[model samples]
Target: MIRHQRQNYDWGINAEGSSLEGGAAQVAMNGDTVFIHYICRDEDGNMVDDSAESEDHPVSFEVGAGEITGNPLFQAFDEAIRGLPLGSTTVLEARGGDWNRELFFEVPRDHAEIQRLEGRYKNQGGLQDGLIVELSNGGSAMVVAVTDDVVKIDANNMLAGKRRIFEVTLLNIEPAQR
Candidate 1:
């Protein structure tokens, strides 16, 4: 069964530490696919990138499976949503060196899809045409060539060297099986 909540609250802790919010615990475990919606802004409060503006707004990926690696933005997100509660919205303040920003995320308790990537396959002789392959670790690569002994693959994620802020909302959580 799936559940959802549409509420917004102040997740910040003031200097005096007066208000303390409490709710159910929702931790994202390994192998679980999480769906989220997000927006990003720079230190100067300028809108940098927003997932809500994309055609497939709210992207989904498996957690702790290295599905969305090579990107600093997603790397920060993986760290932020580790133990986030479902059906709640919170702001995350990330600071490193002179870079500081806030990420807002809303995680819904429902909505998820489990996808499994197949293992490597060896051709009898060799592959002549190029083929895109999805790795078992949830990563992807393009097969440039295949020979009797070796297979050449290009595993590069274009967002590897980019820097950007992100506002993410968790829309669903599929817990890993025991």
Candidate 2:
């Protein structure tokens, strides 16, 4: 009975080690796949976004080096949650730099799909009224307005006007299991 109990204790400790969340994460950066459920918020602690709390599809990334560059809203992930292990929940608040900047970006044709989903309506005719886009997490946005000549997708994120925060959990790490 004593031996069995010791074995169980070791197993529990090992399980904890497998869930550490600091260091260079072994994610799929080159054609690797990672499943994550996450949320976004402004610095003010207001709920700006939440995947677990949303109806939209969970954020899945290919885990590349620069795939997330367009969205400057990654300060939360870059700082505290970058090296987290799989299945770990990482809660991070957006830094001040992520806020206070209106990220004027040009929406490429490839990004048009998300643009349409975000209600990025083209300013056809003399429509001056802005459009509101709702994220899956019940966060509605007015930054992703579209124009006639180009899709003016605001990559600064909907919560750019305020600070940002995030709660991310690694649901799956495909490459590491293999």
- Which candidate number has the best lDDT? 1
Quote each prediction's TM-score: 0.44, 0.45
lDDT of 1 by residue, 10-95 (tens): 32111110111464556566777787777665656788777778888677777865445765445556655555555433343333
Stretches of candidate 1 off by over 4 Å are 1-23, 89-164
Query: How does residue 173 of candidate 1 score in lDDT?
Result: 90
lDDT of 2 by residue, 68-177 (tens): 57443443343233345666665544443344335454455346454555344444432132555544456554444546544443444444445454666777765633
Q: lDDT, candidate 1, residue 107? A: 20
In model 1, what lDDT does residue 22 have?
61
